[model samples]
Target: MAGFANLSQAARTWSIGFMEFDPQNAFNNAGAVLRQLSALLVSYSLSFVGAVLLLVIGYLVAGLVERWLNAALAHIHGFDLTLRNFFSKIARYAILVLVFIMVLGQFGVQTASIIAAIGAVGLAIGLALQGTLQNIAAGVMLLVLRPFRIGEDVQVGSIRGTINEIGLFATSLHTSDGLYILAPNSSLWSQPVTNYTRNQTRSNAITVRIKPDADIDQAQRALIRLAQSDSRVLADKTPSASVSEVADDAVTLTLTYWTAVGDFGGTKNDLTKRAKLTLDQQGLSKV
Candidate 1:
């Protein structure tokens, strides 16, 4: 019985010791886990704060740089406004990309790998957007060479309108008939462009047909008088009248005059109407 009691006591003591050790080990493990979690949270919080600061400061600096560049370009003599805006925007975006890389670095991201991936993606995009890239190239050339300017009347391909805006990818035009046109920069650069507003004055040719025997001299004098009386006609360039063609039953009288470019269409219409009226008053009948 004594031996049996001693064995029971030893067993109880071992059970108690095991129970105490397990709880203490569990508490220690819990404490270790909490400590690791706190350290991880602290690391992440610092990284997040750093990233936010970088983003805010970077965006502010980018905007300031863009504005400063624009102002500086505006002061340059003969610099195109479209070019200035394009360059400023490019600068701002470049700065933003740098800031993004820095922010990623704060989070322990590998920047070299990211740059390589971006390059690969960029190559794919460039291949996919060949036409778009061409337009951008053409746009750069256009801005630098200045074939046409904003608010100028120009005709390219089948499009005719006043230039509303010029951008890196396309050109906007406002037509005389109240329509808007967006033309790709590549097409404009490749095709021939007709600029109507480049010249201060434009020549207008007005032809009137009268009866072959119906006083050619009188008809000529009447046309010349009509052109000269018009205020839109250039005073320095005197109107000239000549017999261009002599048909069987009709004589063609050509009146050439110079007028302000803006007034060319209206002046031509008015002169033709007046010429017809003048010939009727002179008893000249049309063929």
Candidate 2:
């Protein structure tokens, strides 16, 4: 306030001295004006330096807080990695916003007015970004409800892939054939999610048609032996072999077994190959 007053008074004195054409008064006014200008420059220079220091310190503090918050959240059980990162970023941004407000206050700006204006702008932005906000909301719900986790294979609507990353706006996935997919959270949240890896065990079946003349009992015994011999098949559930259909030229033998979900693919392929060999050895070749 005093700096502003001195500057304004010096300007008025200079104007009056020039209008009167008084050489002595003008010389004195010139000195006063220079002094006021020097004082203002020094004051502003200090404020500018202080603002820069505040910015540097505030940025470092924000980064430290983000890291500390992330590390602290890591200890909580069942806390999703996505949520931890999101929350830590929010904290860092909040701190930076406060530091910015403080820096503005150093420039003689009204902090309360700035805060109010910020709120107004935030409201406007929220209104403008409804779809984006929906994605964020859906992302939060996804993290909370845990429909799928990283590295899990899932099918949502028409998209089938392994979960790569769950973010505020989108979920990243890699297809079985290794195609990258960036699906919006809103799309995932609105669809039915099929978590293929959620269950510990999965049931699979292999059906093959045998020669009509083949011995049904022998064929069933061969499939059962093949299932039992494989270590990947779950021991808890007994494998089943049944004559599913009988036709004029062929008979269908269906073998069903339960295997660990992790081994479902390999088990299916291995068992199928072995089943065909076993049936052929038993003289029950397909029609």
Candidate 3:
């Protein structure tokens, strides 16, 4: 009977301690905090995944559109493939910028005000670069006109070089000294441009002075032979070598011939060197 009474008292004391501890209330608050944390983690994960997917979709869309337009415009009656590649790149980049803006917007950013501020800043920057902007405008005109293109040798603004690239605001030229010279299109547009590659073949004229005492007839024959022997020289254009000037010490003979544009510089050098050698071999003298 005493053992049963002690067990009943112990049970009553344990029940009182449980009420004071409040285990159910504690678990309820803990479970709510866990749910909030889990929701936040899921939201952050979704946002990150969404950003990545947006960027990938943007790139693929831009690429496909760029490729399609490039091909279509290249085959258009009045357009050039170079122009197609150029404009397509610009469009693609523009699209990418827009996509980037959208991604930023997804992160709860106020893009409109940001874009407005950017526009204002861009306007200030543009004002600062007025001259460069003019060059860019002129470059657009040059590309449209297509006065010259890559690999074409041209003379503009007292500078001569092979055109390596035609960018938005500047033109790159590889000079004879192996230097790349970027000439602004505003200056290029204002100046006269001479494109040597406009025609398939070009005329090369060589002027050599010989002693006045030398026979003009015999010297003419020698120079003509020198001009004619080269395989690259064309005959249909009517090659000629004649006494063009009678100076105090020498008679200048100008030999004019036609050769492929590819051989412009090489042929000129080879012809000059070989002609001098041939004249010396024949005992011809300007001395």
How accurate locally, in lDDT, is each candidate?
0.92, 0.93, 0.86
lDDT of 2 by residue, 1-287 (tens): 99999999999999997788978877999999999999999999998999999999999999999999999999998888879999999999999999999999888999999899999999999999999999999999999899999999999999999999999899999998989999999999999999999888899999977899988988888889889989998889999999899999899999999998999999999888888887777778773
Cα lDDT tens digits, model 3, 1-287, are 99999999999999999779978889999999999999988987887798899999999999998998898887777575556887899889888988888888878789998789879999999999999899878888888898988899899978899999887789999987898898888989999999999889999898887877878888778888877888889878767887789988888888899999998899899988887887777766575
When summed lDDT is taken over every stretch of 10 residues in candidate 1, the lowest stretch is 278-287
Query: Model 1, which residues run further than 4 Å from truth?
Result: 1-64, 77-82, 96-115
Total clashing pairs for each candidate? 0, 0, 0
- Tens digits of per-residue lDDT, candidate 1, 226-279, equal 889999999899999999999898999999999998898899899988988888
Candidate 3 minimal-lDDT segment of 10 residues: 74-83
Error of 2 at 259 (Å): 2.0
TM-score of each model, paired residue for residue: 0.69, 0.67, 0.60
Clashing pairs in 3: none
Clashes of 1: 0
Model 3, position 21, has a per-residue lDDT of 90
Judging by TM-score against the true structure, name the best candidate.
1
